[model samples]
Every structure is written in structure tokens, then in C-alpha cells.
Target: MPEKFVVVGAGPVGSLAALYAAVRGYHVELYELRPDLRDPATTPLNFTKSINLAISERGVNSLRQTGLTTLVKDVVSSTTPMKGRMLHLRKQGKYVREAQLYDARGKNLLALDRTSLNKTLLDALESMPNVKLFFHHKVVGVDFNKKLAWFERRTPSDPSSRGTEIEISFDFMIGADGAHSAVRYHLMKFTPVAYQQEYIDKLWCQFHVAPSPKDGKYRLPPNYLHIWPQDEAMFIALPNQDQTFTSTLFLTRQGFSDLDAHPDRLVAYFQDKFPAVVPDLIPADELVKQYNENPHLPLITIKCTPYHFSSSGVIVGDAAHAMVPFYGQGMNAGLEDVRVLFDFLDQYPTDRAKALDQYSKVRTPDAHTINDLALRNYREMASDVKSPLYLLRKKIEETLDVYFPGLGFATQYSRVTFSNMPYSEVQRRAAWQARVLNCAVGGLGVGVLGAMWVWGRGGGWARVKRGVLLGCCWIARGVVGVVRGWE
Candidate 1:
């Protein structure tokens, strides 16, 4: 008989995990706290529309590895490709927009509806005979050493009412429950796992920009993720298959309260800051309706060590590392955990304990690094997106990438979004590139100072200019050569 594999949380990550185990001939049972999301009456996320997910290479590769190539293609086909970040800035009573490509090599992020993607995975799992999905079965406890788990089933007559508790045994269990995971909470009792969680001061509220009333086309360009960067708050919109955009407004708690206190001020504030959005994409009345109706949700960051318990159970996805959504890597990272976990299993099929230990040791640093990156990107997305210096640095990096292809030059966004490079390694490399840029600027500064001194001497000014230009050329060539050599 094949080993019994139990998975908690039937979200995308858990559904994918169940699919993987079923493919390996395991008798897989997937449990969820809620009813089946495919039901038309049942909502997946609390919001009417899901927060958009950007499916990048890391997520795509993980899905492809499942041997479900057609599923991957179908999900990808449903998405809108975001080739760049379209920045919206207000100046002198008018809005000016600029496009910043994610990668010079033409890589793009696919904007996917979270609900649709989860449904796709869940539907795929339903088709497999070896996989059984048990909805409304909430995992209440786990005994890691005994390899036994307990669930509180919802009464069928009244789904809100609690039913009897039952126990199930598993050869192995996977937990992709989410940030407030009961599995992770219970696993802590059986094992000494260090954990940390914090709620950022900012909260996010959802908004919607309907398609053009005339022809039902996109109000804004569909090819980019639109961003309006205010100093203390930000608004971003991602396109959907229905031609509308899901907009999220992020602000501090105090800011949200201020808006709540004076509702009329909200329209005036948007007029002054995010000009043209009120009457252009979303009408003034509709904007107010969304602002009043939608809930303000907190953003949390979670970090933990030793995401497993003695080879019997392991935590993946948000349960392992829940990060804020600024970097657009939360889902991608979670899906990656599934891929990485199975890679270790494939390596140590017999010694599962060793595989689990190795996975915790190797994956923790990358997870923490991504958490930090997400926090940092929140600041960049809200404020730095409008900075001239930030834009200059972005242009310089892209220029180097275009001129020196052999040097393997890339921006931080490209490394994080366009490639599957390790997150920790990407952090380290980006720091090195910053230092290189700083040194180059320092050299130019020294050259200019030296030229000024030569002019003061009243004789060597021409020679000094020539020398400075030559020195800059030499430094640029050397930097390119050094970067290429390192690669």
C-alpha cells in the first residue's frame, strides 16, 4: 500500500501539494476549514474580487514541474501580462504617467486572479482518484510523534454548528494553512520552533476601477501594473480578464481614520494627490461607495525557524513565512516551498527526517530575506517610485544591461521578479551592485574636483578635462569587465 499523505488548507499551495503526492501514488486527503470555493454562492476571499497575484518564473516553474503542462498553460492564458510599472504622478493640476519596464530583456509578470488560480488547482486535484478533498473539516490538533491528526468537522445540517471530532493517521502531513495556521500553532507544542510575527502600522483597503463604459475596454493601459505613489500612502491597480482593475489603497491606520472622519475630504484628497482617478477611471460616487463598503485589513509579517517536526509533518507557504505583498512574491515564494520540499523528498526518499531537516536549514535564510525585501519594497512602492534619483538609478542599471549583456547586469526588480535566483543571494548581489555604483560616482566626483583645481592653476585645464574624460571611460570599462569576470 502507498503511504498516506494528509494536507491541511486547500488553497493553491495545499492543492498543489496534494496534486504532487497523488501523482506519486500516495493516498492523499486534503482538508479545509471552509466550504468548497467552486460553489457559486461561496466566496473564496472575503472580498468580492481577489487581490491580484503576479505569477512569475518561480511560480510558473513550480507548476510546470507537476507534469501538468496543460493546467499551467490554461492558467497562464487567463492572465494579463504586466510588462512594466506604470507610475501615476500629479503635477500642476494634471496627471503625468511614466512606464518602467520590469526587465530590459522583455520579461513580464502575469496578473492572475487568486480565486481563479485556486479553483484551477482544486479542480485539477478533484479529477485525481487518489486525492480526496474534505471541506469544512478544520484541523484542531496534531500528534507529530504518533503521526496522528484531529479535525473538527462542521455539522452538515448547519455548517455553522460544530460537529464531532475525529482522528486520522498519516505517514506524512503537510501544512499550508496560512499565516494564522492551527497546524503551525500545534506543531510548536511538539517541537521547539522559534517564531516571530509583527503587524505593520499600515492597513490596506480594496477599490475597483470599472472598464470603460462606452466599449467595456480597460480605462488604463492593460499592459502594466498602475501605481500612484503618495508619500504616506499608495494606490495600485492590476488588470483582470474582465477588463476591469482591482485597486488596493494602502495607508496608515491614522490616515484611514482621518478619511473616515471626514468623508468629503476623501474626494478632495484624491483630487489633489491622485488626480484624474476620481472622474476618469472610477467615478466619484463609486469611489466613495468602495471606500465605505470595503474593509481595512492589516498587513502582517511572519518569520520562523525549523518549519518541520521530526519528518512526520512540515509547514509550507504563508504558514512558514507570511510576508507583506509589496514585492508580489508572497504566492510565488509559497509555491516555491512546495517545489523545494519535494526536491528534498526526491533526494532522500528513504530518510525523510534528514530531508526535512535539510529543508529547514536551507530554506529559512531565503524566507527571512524575502520577508525583509517585502518590507523594504513597501517603502519603495509608496514613495521612492516618484524619486528622481531612484528613476536615474533604474535607468543606469537598464543601460548597463543593454550595453554590457555579457556583464549580466540586472536591476533588483529583475532579479526578484524575472528570475529564479535565490532570494538571499539576490540581496547580496544587489548590495554589491550598489557599492559599485557608489564607487563609480565617487570616481567621477574626484575627477571633477581635480579638473577644477587644474583650472585654478591657470595652465593645465585642457589636459585635465581630457584626463577626466579618459579616467571616466576607463572606470566604466573596468567595472563592466569586473562584473563580467565575476559572473
Candidate 2:
């Protein structure tokens, strides 16, 4: 049996992977390219102006599998429950808000700080006896056949200096080192790893909105997330524990350039479109400087196959499937991979090698599905949902729900968010349901017009009832067709 296992990267996902392996009795050593993040004196990575992440049932259910609910709960305690998407609509000069609940009785997902979560997981890993964290170690190479890792240790010699080369070897290894993973590059030499990377042109810069200050506690109602929708460009805000709101402005490359050209105009644009959020929440000068100055990073997705090193090692998290952040499931999905992996290991207790092999195959499909879905959702969230056709369909579904209580909850968004259905399966079912609804509505509309034309000549009440019955039968037939396809 392999004795020493090494985990590359010490982000939340990698740390969790290390924690899981350690708990399962693997002696794990986790290597991080950056210095110890737990050290208060260390300068932080300029990753993003602190962002808020959402966690739904898929993520929560998996986190609970580690029997680490209390540990997760403690870190996530200050989080706000967003019952559903609070869609923001702009018309004329004002904005309108609507609540599209994810479930029938308003089951909510969670929103909290990414930093707090990473710190919490890091603390847990540090507390484990089987886990050893090596920070400031840059992974330069990985040898799958020999199970060796190459790194350069970084430490400030004086105030303007650094450290030297270091190499470590283990019995087994995992490539949780992220999109440009060195481990993955080396492993692909042995395994025919199918890999793809796509760079999305969309750029994002984040800013904050301070909560109203009274004696101390938050002045704004912290429950719901805030959004300012302008079709092509949008702003979204989620509350934090310190009574401050972290907000992100998502815009296209062209849009970003336009703002960059006339830097001072950002305040003017916000004052016109999202007037309520500006001036008071974020001052004009500060907002504009952030918009023109912050480096707008392109979102990228990376996917790889057979994420392992021979029979002794494996990979998880962003290294395996790097997804766009639009779905708010990137980290959540990574965390889930750890849970799924451990479950597989437990099931194949005696065949650890086979378990690793199967784990990669089973998880990759879902990762690809969600990566595409997440990118598509950006369109739904920012533009398509604001269209007239979109609103009309939503109106139709809502009207149906007045009589058919469960029908609205059967809407596509609900299935994606509230139900534990597969992402691809949810899209497939929703499309099938749409066809059925269309056919029934068409048949009913035609029947009503025909009856009105005939009944204009004073037809008997029995004739009117007969027409209605026939129309209802046609709709029922369509519904039956949909139900059959699902089975």
C-alpha cells in the first residue's frame, strides 16, 4: 500500500481534499505555492475584491457527508439565506424587483465570504495530525512514475530577497493545483489526458456598498441579495458579516473599454441607471477609480480527463474541472468532488486503484455539463430573462399556478435550483415540458375562438360545455405525452 500521499495547492478545495484523505487514514502532505495565508502579516493575493459565494443543496449535502456539518456551520454562521433569485428590471428610469423562488415553499441557498470559508477549512486541516502543510513551495514538476515533486521554497531573506530550490517525493500524489497545474502537465505524459481550455471575454471588477450604520449592526435588511440589471451590463451585491455589501460589476470587453476611456463617467452611468445604489452606498470617486484601475480578468474554464498519476494518485477541484463563476458552484463543486471521492473509496474498500479510476470517469461528465450550464446562465441572469418573451412565459406559468399549485415550482429555474436533478437532465425535462405546455395552450386558444364564433349565434349551454370538455381533453393528451417521455 502507498504510505505517503502529497496534495498540491492549499486553497479551500485542495485543503478539503487533504483533510478527507487524512481522515481516511492517508498520511498527507499539502504543498501551497503561496506563503501561509493564516499568517496575519503575509500580504494577500490580489485575487478579487472579496467576493461572496452561494451554496445550494448539492454543495451542502456533500459537505455534510464528511460529518463536518458543525465545522462548516461555524464558519458559515453569518451567511444570509437567499430564497431565490431577486431579478432586477429596469424600465424608463426606474428599477423594478421580482422574486423568483427556487422551491415551492421558498427553500433558500446560502451566501457568504469566500475568505472566511477558506480560512475555516485551512484551520481544520492544520488541526489534523496526518496533514502537514508546506507553504511558499512552488511546484515546478511532477514525476508520476517515480512519485516525485519539484519546488522552489520562497522566504524573504532580508526585506528584498527570497529562498531556494526544494524537492519532495511521496508514495502517492493529487493534482489539485488548479487550471495551469504542473502535476496535470506531467501526468498527461503517461495518461492520454484529454484537455480543453476556453477563455471567456467577459471581464469583472468588484466594489463594495456599505450598510447603513446606526449604533453598529447592519442597517439594510441583510436577507436578500441586491442586483442592478441593465441587460448588457449588470451589478450584483451580497451582504457580508461586517454590515458591508460586496458587489461585482460584470461587463463585456467592449463595455469595459468604454468605461476605461471615460473613467469619470461610471458614476454618471450608475446615477442614471442604478441611482438607488450609488452616492450613498459607494461614493462616485471611489467607484470610478476601481472601474478604470482594477485589472479585469477573463473568466476561463479548464477540463481534463483521467485525472490521476498511474494507479497511485488523483486530482480534484479546479485542476480537474475549472468552471466559470457565474453559477456560484465552482468551489462548491470542488468541495463536492472530495465527498464523492471518499464515498467511492469506502465502497471499493479493497480496490483503491479501481476506485480512483472510476471516480475520474463518473465526475468528469457532470463537470462538463455544469461548466456549459454556468456560462449559459450568465445570459439568462444578465439579458434573456429581461426580455418580453421571457416575462410572458413566466406570466403564463404563474397564471397556471393559480389553479395548478405545483406547476410554477416545476419551472426550469426551480428544477435547476430547488430540485436535486442532474443539470443536463433538468434542461432536457424543462424543454420537454415547454413543448407540452405550448401544444396545450395552442389547442385551448383555437378551441376557445371556435366556440366563441359558434356561440355568437346563441348556441345551447350544453354545446358550450361540450366545446370546453373537448378543449380540456386535448390539453390532457398533451400532458400525458410529456409524462410518458420522462418515464
Candidate 3:
């Protein structure tokens, strides 16, 4: 008989895990705390707004591994390509828009609807004979040693009744439950896992920008992710399939509270900072109403170690490492976890315990590194993205990539979003590039200062100013020469 594999949480990660196990001939039972999202009576989880997802190479690679080519194609077909970030900035008392390409080589991120993609995966699983999806079956407990798990079943007929408890036996269990994971909580009884959860001060509220009434077309550029980066907060919008855009406003808890008290302030705030938002992308009335009606959800980051309990059970996705959505890698990383875990299982098929052990050893650091990167990216999205220094570094990196071609030059964003290279390695390379840029910029500044001092000693301020400008021009020429040399 084939091994019975039990998966808790029928979200994308759990559904994908069940699909993989079923493909391997394991009789799979996928349990979820909620009813099937595709059901009419079941409301979608993100009812406040249908958030858009940026699907890049990492996520695409994971889907490719599942052998569900048709499903992958279906999901990809529904997406809009976000080729770059269209930054809305204030310059000389007026707002201007600038496009910063993600990659000079024409690589772009796919903007996908979260619900549509999840439904695609769930639909694919429903067709599989070996996979049984038990919706409204909430996992209550687990005994890894006994290979037993407990769940409470909720019947649709008796919505108010206390559910009946059911005990199921499985050869192995996978936990893809989210940050507040019941599976992770129960598994801790069997394994000594190191766990940490943090709620960042930032809270996010979703908003919508409807299609233009004039032509029934997109109000903003549909090809780029729109960003309004203010120091204390940020507003971002990603295009959807229906010409509408799903926008989010991320702010500190106190900022949300302040805005809540004076609802009128919301419109004025946007008008002052993001001058084009009101009466342009979003109407003045709609913006205030959405702010009041939509829930201000907290952003969280979670990190845990020893993801598996011997051969019997393992945790994947948010259960292992939940991150902030700033980097848009939460779902991608979770999917990658499924691929990596199975890769180990494939390697040590006979001794599953050793495979689980090796998985924990190798995947933990990468998970933590991504969690950190996500946190850092929150600051970048909100503030540093518009900084002159940040743009300069990006220019340097992209210049090298454009000119060098085969010299292995790449931006951190490209490395993280456009490749399957490990997250830790991406972080390392980004840091190295940062150091090199710092040294180059520092030398330029020192050269300019030295010239200012020496020339000003006799030539006065005007000549000194001219000399400093000339020094900067000289540095620019040298950088251009390097680019030319590479070509």
C-alpha cells in the first residue's frame, strides 16, 4: 500500500504539497479550516481587496516542478507584466513620474491575481484521483511518533454546532498552515523547535482604482508597478486583469489611528504627498470611504528552526518562515520550500528522516535571510527608493549589467526576482556590490574636496567651484570609459 500523506491547510502551499505527494502515488488528504473558496457561499479570504501578486522566476520555477503545465499556463495567461516601477515623485513643487526598469535585459515580473492563482491550483488538485480535499476540517492536534493527527470537522448544514473530532493516521504529514499555524503549535510538542514571531509597526490597508469611465481603460500605466514613496509611509498599486488596480497604503499603526480620527485628513494627505492620487487614479470620496471601511492589517515576520519532526512530519511555507510582503517573495518562498523539501526526499527516498534533517540544516539560513531581506525592502519601498544614493547604486549595477553582458554582473533585484539562486547568496552579492559602490563614491567625494581645498587656496570660491565640477565630470568620464571598455 502507498503511504498516506496528510497535509494541513488547503491554501496554495498545502494544495501544491498535496498535489506533489499525490503525483508520487501517496494517498493524500488535504485539510483546511475554511470552506472551499470556489464555493458560492464561501467568501474569498481577502474580501477587503483582491491583492495582486508579482510572480517571478522563483515562483514560476516551483510551479514548473509540479508537472502541471496546463495549470501553470492558465495562471500565467491571466497575468499582466510589470516591467518596472513608475515612481511618482515631487520635483520643484510639482509631481513627475519616472520609470525605473527592473532589468535592462527585458526581464519583467508578472502581476497575478492571488485568488485566481489559488483557484487554479485547487482546481488542478480536485481533478487528481489520489488527492482528497477536506474543506472545513481544522487540524486540532498531532502526534508525530504515533503518526496520528486530530481534526475537527464542520458540516455545512450545522453551522453553529460544535464540530466532531476525527483522528486520522498518516505515514507523513506536511504543515503549510500560515503564521498562526496550529500544525506548528502541535508539532512543537514532539520537537524542540526554535520559533520567533514579530509584528512590525507597519499596518497595511487596501484600496482600489477603478478603470477610467471615459474609455473604460486603465487610469495609470498598466505595464509598471506604481509607487508613491513617502518617508513615513508608502502607497503602491499593481495592475489587474480587468484594467483596475489593486492599491495598498502601508503606514505605521499611529498613522492609521490618526487618519482614522480625522477621515477628511486622508484625502488632503494624499493630495499633498501624492498630488496625482486624488481625482486622478482614485476619487476623493472613494479614497476616504475605503480607508474607513477596509481593515488595517498588521504586517508580521516569523522565523523558526527544525522545520521537521524526524520522518513523520514537516512544516513548509509560512509555517516555517512568514515574511512581510514588501519584497513580494512570501508566496514564492513558500512554494520553493515545497520544491526543496521534496528534492531532499527524492534524494534520500528510503531514509526520509535523514532527508528531513538535511532539509532543516540547509533551508533554515536561506529562510531567515529572506525574512530579513523582506524587512529591509519595506524600508526601501517606503523611503530609500527615491533617494539619490539608492538610484545611483542601481544605475551603477544596471550599467555594468547592460555593458558587461557575460561578466556575471547583476542587480540584487534581478538576482532575487529573475533567478533561482539562493536568497543568502543574493544577499551576499548585494552587500559586496554596495561596498564597492561606497568605495567608488567615497573616493570621488574625497577627490572633489581635495581639489576644492587646493584650488581655493589662491583661486577663490568661483575657481574652486569650477574645479570641483570638473572633478565630478572627470569621474563620470572614467565610469563611461569603463562601460565602453566592457563593450
- Residue-pair clashes per prediction, in order, are 0, 0, 0
Model 3 stretches astray by more than 4 angstroms? 46-50, 157-160, 443-487
- Give TM per candidate: 0.95, 0.88, 0.91
Q: Among all windows of ten consecutive residues in candidate 1, which has the lowest summed lDDT?
A: 42-51
Give candidate 3's whole-model lDDT: 0.86
The sequence of per-residue lDDT tens digits that candidate 3 reaches over residues 1-487 is 9999999988778888888898898999899887788888777655335346788898888888988778678879989999999999998987899898988789989998877878898898889898888987878789999999888888866644669999999999999988899999988999999989999999988998999999999999999999999978899999998999999998889998998898768889899877699989888988888888888898889999999998999999999999999888988898899999999999999999999999999899999999999998877877888789888878878888899765456788889999999999888767765555554576578668867686758877777767667667656654554444422
On the 0 to 100 scale, the lDDT of residue 69 in model 3 is 70
Cα lDDT tens digits for candidate 2, 37-136: 6688767574345356887776666656666657758655857787666666666766667666555556777887766777877888888888888887
For lDDT, candidate 1 versus 2, the one ahead is: 1
Write down the TM-score for model 3: 0.91
Comparison by TM-score, 1 against 3, better one: 1
Model 1, global lDDT? 0.88
Candidates ranked by TM-score, best first? Answer: 1, 3, 2
| lDDT per residue as tens, model 1, 1-487 | 9999999999889998998888889999999988888988775554254467899998998898899869898789889999999999867767799898888889999999888888899999999999999998988889999999999999744677888899999999999999999999999998899999999989998888888999989999999999999978888999999999999988999999999999999988887777678889888888899899888889999999899988899999999999999999999999989989999998999999999999999999999999999999988988888789999999888998899866666899899887889899888878877767776876787677777777777747686887588559756854874566433
